[model samples]
Target: MRNDVVRLGRLSGERSGDMMHFLSSMRADRYIAGADILVDIAHVLMLDRQKINDRATTRQLLPALLRLHDKGIPEEVFDDRFEDVHAGIESLLIESLGVEAGGRMHMGRSRNDEVVTCIRIRLREDLIAQMTALLKVREVLLTLSENHTESTMPGFTHLQHAQPTTLAHHLLAYEQAFSRDFDRLKEAYARVNQSPLGAAAFASTGYPIDREFTATLLGFDGLVTNTMDAVATRDFALETLADLTIMMANASRLCEELIFWSTSFVKFVIFDDAFCSTSSIMPQKKNPDTAEIMRAKSGSVFGAFSGALVTVKGLPMSYNRDLQELTPNIWRGMDDAGESLRLLADMLASASFDTKRMSEEAGKGFSTATELADSLVRSCGIPFRTAHNIVGRAVQKGDLSLATLEKAAGEVGGGISLAGKGLTQKDIDRMLEVRYSLELRKAPGGPAPEAVIAALGERRKQHHHDAELTRKKQAKLAKAKEHLIAEARRLVA
Candidate 1:
């Protein structure tokens, strides 16, 4: 049995070493160690203010905690022999100040409330990091879109060319999807920022602790209000995991497209050498390995979310050990999604697009057939269904010539006359041209160059607005931390 486990003294028996290791959360607790220390300090300051603990006790405990906060949790604090980081820190304090003052440090709070509070603090920081990373990706998308508004490409439905569009338009589609993801994460942050510190093991503490004061000191927006709900629920973590999973799902889709675009057959994009790898045996292979790995790893993130959901599903409330299994999943999910976003942003910024090949491909695969039908509707005064039938028949005949259109018109146009309809060969040729096809569809959100450019301008404004919002959020957190540490120092002095 470890000395610290014996020192804990809640259980009287000699605990098995294997049991100690099995129940230990030291590895995952490292993530929250710093937050845990800040939480301790906040709780201590609150205790001192409420006169629950003497000023001498606060004087000794706050400095020890402030020193730990300054230098960081030591390597010894992560020793599995300690069962968890909370026990390890408490053991250190008991050793330093003797049990009288050190034991009193946990007066108004339980490890139940403390752990969740630390998780929220750390999770909010990570959420901001993810939001910032997502913004960088959005920035990259906007910059790429600005450059490629006129770079034509064949847009597909069912993997068949359906229309002529620009690379900018396709990239902006992803930007719009990811923009929703950012909004969700930002919304999740609001719920995650609430405090659970004074809940005290699922019920409010008897000590006259000021929950609001502790929440402010720890930079939380407010209390969780219901003490049992505070300790009992992990819906906040589940919500965050859901947000990350959705973002990663979007990322995987973009990666799938990038993988396809980088293929030798498609040749629409060439990723930078840094993001690609050559096959060891096949000398000619420059694989889209980064994108492929990102695509695969998205599954792991999804699995983490699934595992978290199942872990929380069957457990009776009020803080089960099963909840311990969920924290590592949140950490892993956030790390995977955040790293993927950062790498994707870098990969895209370094990539080169085959604009000429895209333009040439845009003109193939009967891509402008829709425009031909629209022209027939406009110039010949035919119903759209009749126009659609004429184009479909002409496409089946494998040509867009006047003879083919005239023949198809007789079969499918239902007596709609083509004679003196002003439908000349020049009109047919113009309708079949990719650039002319693109230009004619100038409605808002169309694939036309002008429409794409206008959309890009609006997206840039939105990005700037989001970026400013992120900056303000970051500044607020920073200011809170500074104030927290300064106040702790004041109490110590």
Candidate 2:
């Protein structure tokens, strides 16, 4: 909108305002503005170290750059007058210091490399935050599991009760899924932390530049090496989106369960008032709005990932204007997933379980019939097939009493005698009791309280290990930032 601002040097004539607006990525560029500043500072420091820019030029540029960093980029530069934050920052530098000195700050880099470098920096920070949110949700799950080790419930298949399980075991299944999500994010961080700064416009610059020097200053794990790959590839973004999509899918599954559990017909869980809302038309409705939204958000994340895949699918090697479209997708996916993780943690922590109702439901639906069949095989010395037939008939007769068992045995056990064996009515009753059924299956990964407690201990240990990894990565980035600022100050002094 302002004619005073410098236009691209390659184009000499007046530019169309509508064309600039159409070409602009200014809306998404704000997210990477701070990272852009860091990239500039690191590039300038590398330039000074290589003696590409004279001492006088370095001193003049460093102080102004530091000032920009301290006070933040001028708010006016965000207009459609510029193509992106990269150009906007360079233009401001030129406006203040004139072309000769301020312009040299771009000595060995192009916006192609500069923008991607900024993206990686910003994305790595986001990945760390996402990992922290995941760990918090996992911790909540572990704590809930520990408290509910003895609380029994029906575990379902095809929406019908298939077995009796402890709440601890059920919660830990989701914990295992989220633990894998954390691992995926950690792997993606390694790829996102690589530097792409020195690959100017898809080729190495003729200038004597040390890519490694800038990489270290910017806290990149390593260089992106190939110039074309550095600028052209966004598979790192794709990988991260894939991980987020999978993570949200896991979250959505748990959210689906929470929604079902909160229903009046199920009544397995009661959400806190903070997470529920009353219907405007029906005051009696206490809807699980938060969980429902989180569940729906998984589809949004999927769409973002799908859109990113489509954007990158057919692009040829080297940079294209289409790459500009991917950044907003990354931001949208990350924000949705991060907020969902945090809110899910808070929601689960505040919820109350209907343990009595869960226990009652655990006893219905022939949930322990397998245990009864196993008891017949173990105590009566009957073959498992014969035992299964006897129990199937008992269940089919719609009663589990001693009289029903005797009739079922006569009808289906092929004349197999129940006389003089150690099996008795008391034994059959014990096998049908949910607690007794649980105790008999104390193998590792089982739903028995002892097994669930053992699993909880191991998961807690894993949580500690994962949390430490996240902290170390974050600390390394902080240390690099402090060192960068100190080095800039030293140059100015």
Give the winner by TM-score.
1
**lDDT, candidate 2, 295-405, per-residue tens:** 999999999899999999999999998999988899999989989999999999999999999998998899999888888888888999998898889899997777787
Q: Give candidate 1's TM-score.
A: 0.98
Q: What is the TM-score of each candidate against the true structure?
A: 0.98, 0.97
- The models' CA-based lDDT, in order, is 0.90, 0.91
Cα error, candidate 2, residue 270 (Å): 1.1
RMSD for each of the candidates: 1.4, 1.7
Q: List clashing residue pairs in candidate 1.
A: none
Worst 10 residues of 1 by lDDT: 1-10
Q: Estimate, for each residue in 1-493, the C-alpha lDDT of model 1 and write its tens digit.
A: 2357334556565668888788888878989999999899888889999999999999999999999999887788777777789988998898878889888998878889999999999999999999999999999999999999999999999988999999999999999999999999999999999999899989887788899998888888888999999998999999999999999999999999999988889999999999989988999989999999999879989998999999999988688988888989989998899889999999999999999999989989899999899888888888888999998998999998988888898898875557558788888999999999999888988889899989988888888888898888888888888988898899877
Candidate 2 residue-wise lDDT at 275: 97
Candidate 1 residue-wise lDDT at 90: 90
| TM-score, structure 2 vs. true | 0.97
Clashing pairs in 2: none
